[model samples]
Target: MNVLPQSKHYNLTHYQQRYNWDCGLSCILMILSTTQREQFLNNFEAICKEEGFGSSTWTIDLCYLLQRYQVRHEYYTQTLGIDPNYTQHMYYSKIIDKDEKRVTRKFKDAKAHGLRVMQRTVDMDVIIKHLARNGPVILLTNASLLTCDICKRNALEKFGYAGHYVVLCGYDMDSKKLYYHNPEVQDGHICRCLSEAMDTARTAFGTDQDIIFIYEQQQSSDQ
Candidate 1:
């Protein structure tokens, strides 16, 4: 039986990020706090310190943090290892090595802890499938292309890739819109963007197409 998928929405308490680089953590908290789990809800500062949050964080760090909290999820990234091409780019050249070392450590730690890391790019179809199956997602995206409130409020012109995190909670097929919580907002709120634009930001350069597809339980695929 073919079941037509309608708009899917999940309840969540928005968490506007506290720090410039903590959008990823804030997004994770937004989803987890909405659920029964509360371990991470009240430990924002502690988690940041433990995770060594700093100038920048990577997809691997997020996956490892999810594992640390015993949350079930699948980690996907187009890059199997740190991309050498990033170091050559002027925008990231200064911080690329520092980020590389940190992310490499997290990658090894996540694997050592038995998390399955998928070496693949995330696309719109995959995102839609996850939502259809009742799973929420947090993925890296280019803020410049995302064009959130800050972009419009500041009348900013899109130029370089500014990597940020966003949670995908729902989608309306009829409207061709994807809905998610944007932790970048000063006062957190659900953000809606065109599916095509969202995918473009998700797969943008510097993002590395990194994403975390979360399951609703613990140890769902920890083998």
Candidate 2:
């Protein structure tokens, strides 16, 4: 249970979602806030609209945006056994359907923009490792998984809001608490028990696994 010495939180009031379904975009903005990237800050909405990220944003949409802005990043999701039905349930169930072929195209677009993307199944250990290194992770989870009572209640009222995203910024191992930024929450940060955080993250896609997006700034020399 290693924790960062201090919390890394970001205030992204300006980037709050204009639509109820833009949590994914908001989460990405929160991560970009950490880097203090002026370009993204200046043209946030334009970038989102250009990428066609409105009601729902997929992993590839985020990767493409990051790559377009020259932000180095990677994406991760637990690998599940080959189950076409399960895949349909997770992605195509929505009104805005995304098939494997569409998803693959998004990945190709991101690569074309020069973004490094990777998808793999990872355990809590891997997540903790990233937080230990002071890396902010974008976690896709059910909005109800949030510890905030108001947030959970709102999620219940909104249809199709079970799927949401948040940024995990830090943890206090000594206190066994996890700190994160909820774009839906007005407050800058929210704190909950480490166990609760993990439990909520497990609700994603009913897989009880994590869908994580990690972004590392590319060194100028590397570019």
For each of the candidates, give the backbone clash count. Answer: 0, 0
Q: Candidate 1, residues 1-223: lDDT per residue as tens digits?
A: 7563878876667888877887887777775634423667566567767787564777777777777777789988888768888988776787777777777776766667889897887568778878777478898988877854333522156568777899988888988888888887766667887788788888888888988898775322110
Instruction: Report model 2's TM-score to 2 decimal places.
Output: 0.70
User: Which ranges of candidate 1 are over 4 A from the true structure?
Assistant: 1-4, 34-45, 148-156, 218-223
The digit string of per-residue lDDT tens for model 2 on 1-223 reads 6444444333333345557777777776765645544666577678766776545566667667666655555666553222355545544366334444545566666557666555576766666666655356777776654564334443345443266667776665665666666667665546454645655555555432445545455311110
Best by TM-score: 1
lDDT of each: 0.75, 0.57
- In model 1, residue pairs whose N, Cα or C atoms come closer than 3 Å (at least 3 residues apart or on different chains), thus clashing, are none
| lDDT, candidate 2, at 196 | 56
